[model samples]
Target chain A: MLDAFLGWTGVVFVFIGVFFLFLGALGILRLPDLLNRLQAGTKSTTLGVVATSIGVGLIVRGWILFAAALAVFLLMTNPISSHAIARASYRAGVKLYPGTHPDKCEERKWKLPEDGEEK
Target chain B: MRNDTPILVKKITALSLITILMVGFFWAFTEMPKGSSVNVNNRVSRLYILKNVKAATKSLNSGNFFAKGMKPLRSDVPYSPITFGKSANLEDGAANVVTSIVVDYRGFDTLGEVTVLFLAATGVAMLFFGKRKKNIIKAQASLIMSVGTRIAYAVILLFGIYIFVHGHLTPGGGFPGGAVIASGVLGLFLGNDHYESNHLGLKLFESLSGMAFVIIGLTGLFSVNSFLANFLPTGVIGDLYSAGFIALIYIAIGMKVGAELSAVVDSMIVDTEEEWS
Candidate 1:
């Protein structure tokens, strides 16, 4: 009974994870500009991978250790990778979306050289 | 002649090459036995699995050849049953059969592979030889990236070590382990703009490890009658101390490969100043 319950729960988690991953891909396609797309892509994918791996760990009795370790590694690395991309893009002078407001990077004086004068 | 080749000629050449490749592939495919009907009882793998290669070799040497289409009976050559953790002093006692085959049965091939990798590394290093500048990234790496890379590098290095050390017992081996270590070095390069790996140290380590491999093989040739033979006593299977010289060979390969790859990464990342004379 417990095994059946765990299996069903795992299946539900896997379904949710897949759904989130699909949504993340869709967001990546539809989102405006680089930063916005990265936000949608990285955050949702991180959650999706974590949940999917955990679900898989639950399903496979012997794989829990490796699965959990993978989840932790992904959780730590994904955000940092996204942050690096965002920083690189900003420094490289990729323009933000026209409709977007609130220039926090400009306010903080994080802008590098003038536009077109790439270092 | 090379640059001004006609499009029609190029297309024809590509088509002919593909046709030849496909023909060879199909010919090999026809020779392969299909489906579950294929019998493995008479195959050499049976002796490997049972750890009875010595018996089979002895039988073959003593002029006990099997008749046409007839499998060798147990009465002809006895096969000893090998239980994990109980069997000792077997000819090749690696728990991972692939490791046993690669390191013990066809070690010369592995040496050739290592030499190929060395030549490739040497080529890369030679390409970026002489006065060089750092290939600077436009944007400085973020704080998180730098710190995270340091932590991740350590973890990756440890994991690579674990992989090569357990090559005799697990699916991973020297090549993959070295790749993992090189990836860590790549991360280091990305995270730090001024990060310079010690060139002399890497070269020395690489050469030393390569020499170690050749020396071990020479030792085997001197002690035993064959090159790269299992000279040491292979302990019980599944133990860390088992598999004769497989673990030692893997360690040497792992170090050599890691150093070579790291040097390659260093050469590629550091920009060479062009001398357009």
Candidate 2:
């Protein structure tokens, strides 16, 4: 009974993972800006990876350790990668969307007149 | 003859070339036999699994083929293919056949591959080597990015070490693990201004590892009367210390690869990490 329940849960989790991945792929295709695409890609992919790995672990024998490790790595690295991409875009002077409000990082650049001044 | 060929002739030549390439690619893809389709039952892997660990048997291809060729190959293999992935666990006492094969069976090939990689790294470093200009200021990454990159770098380094350490028992091995380590250091070089690769540390790590690999091979030659023979004791299979020289060789490879890759990266980023004056 427990095995069946776990199997069913895995199936459901896999479906959910597929859904999130599909959404993320769509967002990547449709998103206007680089930041928007990265945001869509990272967040959804992280969650999708977690769900998919868990699903696979439940379905397969002796895969829990690998799944857990992969989840931990994805969780740790995804946001960090997104942050790096954002930083790269900003450094490259990529303009924000026209309709977007005032940017805080841009504002902070004006606030700090000299280098090594900001905490 | 005119300086230029006719447009019609040019088009025909291009078309013929494209058609030939496409046909060649398709023929190669379709006609070639897949490795997976081959009967594993006929392979030495089947026999390797059934028997207990022993000294390397002289194969028909290697030597003494005429006498040994008389006996029929074993058919009563106890375990199926599913249960036994590779005979490395039973015969060689190494869990990972990929490592065993790469570092043991085809070691000389791997040594040549390593040499090629080293030469490439050296050539790249030499090509990029020069005195630094004082005026070229590098822009620092954002605080959040810097912190995140540092954390990621640490995680990646740990993961690489783990990969190479468990190479004999796991899916990953020295080459991939070393690449992982290099990428992590590359992240540091990109994010941090003061992230200079220590020449002494890198050089010592690389050279010592290379020397250690050679020494082990030489010791095997002396001990077993063969190059890179299983000289060290093969402990019980599936343990960290089980694979003996395989693990040690992988560790050495990992260090050498990581150091060499770091040297390559350091060469690319001249201003940040310069060679000694």
Candidate 3:
């Protein structure tokens, strides 16, 4: 009974992993801007990796579990790297949607105080 | 235009071919898992230590005086002191023993790590500082979002402090806590447009903490044979006041990392502003 339960949990984890992997690929293809695409790709892929690692960990216990934990830790770091890349792309003159307004970077010079009063 | 189209097509094809080749090579190499025999030496030693430690601890709790006096043999290569009746919990001064070891006993490695951090900060600052370009996207946060975010920011700031303070007793230490503190500043960056960090204070903290670390190392040079030796009295073991040089090193690391990371984040955010102007 315990073995069956473990097998079912493993299958569920694998399914979730596959779902996240598909979602990440779809997001990469579908997202409009570079930043949005990067976010989608990193987040979904990280989740996918974590789920897959957990499934693998459950199937092969002991030392393999350490590998799974390491994978999850690596997954957590993926977003930070992706964010850096997206920021770099933005700084390198990548364009975004036409409707976006009042760029924070542009308004830094003429920024008004929080209370709508001049500093 | 026609020539350019063909060139682009050829480039794309070549890129894809290379990518496929690389992927195939990696896959093929990964498939051959040359399994090595498990070296049970460390595991066996660890198990033996754990068993004995557990029994000793149990006996101590149960008022068995003989078992309580038994001391575990310290590893000789590492040269950890074998002080009897003192549970020299090296990791108690910092959550990560490895980090404590690297930064405290091996202060030289920490010097390199800090230097790398400093270089990374300077590099990012130089790259982004004082450049002006247009950013089209605008942050349109609602009033509720703005207020709630500020509250959350305060909570996270406090949490970061907690992590830094109890770093000796917890899973988190200076680096992680410092990063968390940096993220809190990021929250400000997200919420406000013209949020500039106090550059002078950050620089002062960075320089001072770094100097203190060096001074501590030099003290060890004068007092002991090894660099970053525990020159101070090793107080009552297992107490917070214990671990002579360990606590001092942790404090120095905490200050340095916190300041450095804050400066880095500040620079990254400020550089974006310069690009816009």
Error of 1 at A24 (Å): 2.0
Query: Which parts of model 2 have CA positions greater than 4 angstroms off?
Result: A104-119, B1-37, B41-91, B128-136, B272-277
Q: Each candidate: how many clashes? A: 0, 0, 4
Which candidate number has the best TM-score? Answer: 1
Candidate with top lDDT is 1
- Number of the predicted model whose DockQ against the real structure is largest: 1
Give stretches of model 1 more than 4 Å off: A1-9, A92-95, A106-109, A113-119, B1-38, B62-66, B70-75, B78-88, B132-137, B273-277
Per-residue lDDT of model 1, residues B76-159, tens digit only: 655456788888888887999889989888899999999999999999987788777645455556678889998889989999
Ranking by lDDT: 1, 2, 3
In model 1, which residue pairs have backbone atoms overlapping below 3 Å?
none
Lowest summed lDDT across 10 adjacent residues in model 3 chain B is found at B44-53
Estimate, for each residue in B1-277, the C-alpha lDDT of model 3 and write its tens digit. 3666678788898899999999999999887657565432334243232223344345446654233323333232232443333655433233344544555545688778877887887787677777443433344333443454466567667767767665544567667777777787776666554455688799898889878888898898899777776677655444566656766666676778878888877766653554454
What TM-score does each prediction get for chain A alone?
Answer: 0.90, 0.87, 0.76
Q: Cα deviation of B239 in candidate 1 (Å)?
A: 2.8
DockQ of 2: 0.30
Model 2 lDDT tens row, B1-277:
3559898898898899999999999999998779778554455664444333232153444443234443434322234332333334444667777777778777778778888888998898777777654424345566766777788898899989999999988999889999999999899977775667786588678889888888888998999898887787766667788766888888988989999998888878755334555
Q: By descending DockQ, how would the candidates be arranged?
A: 1, 2, 3
- DockQ, all models: 0.32, 0.30, 0.06
Model 3: how far is B39 from its true place, Å?
8.2
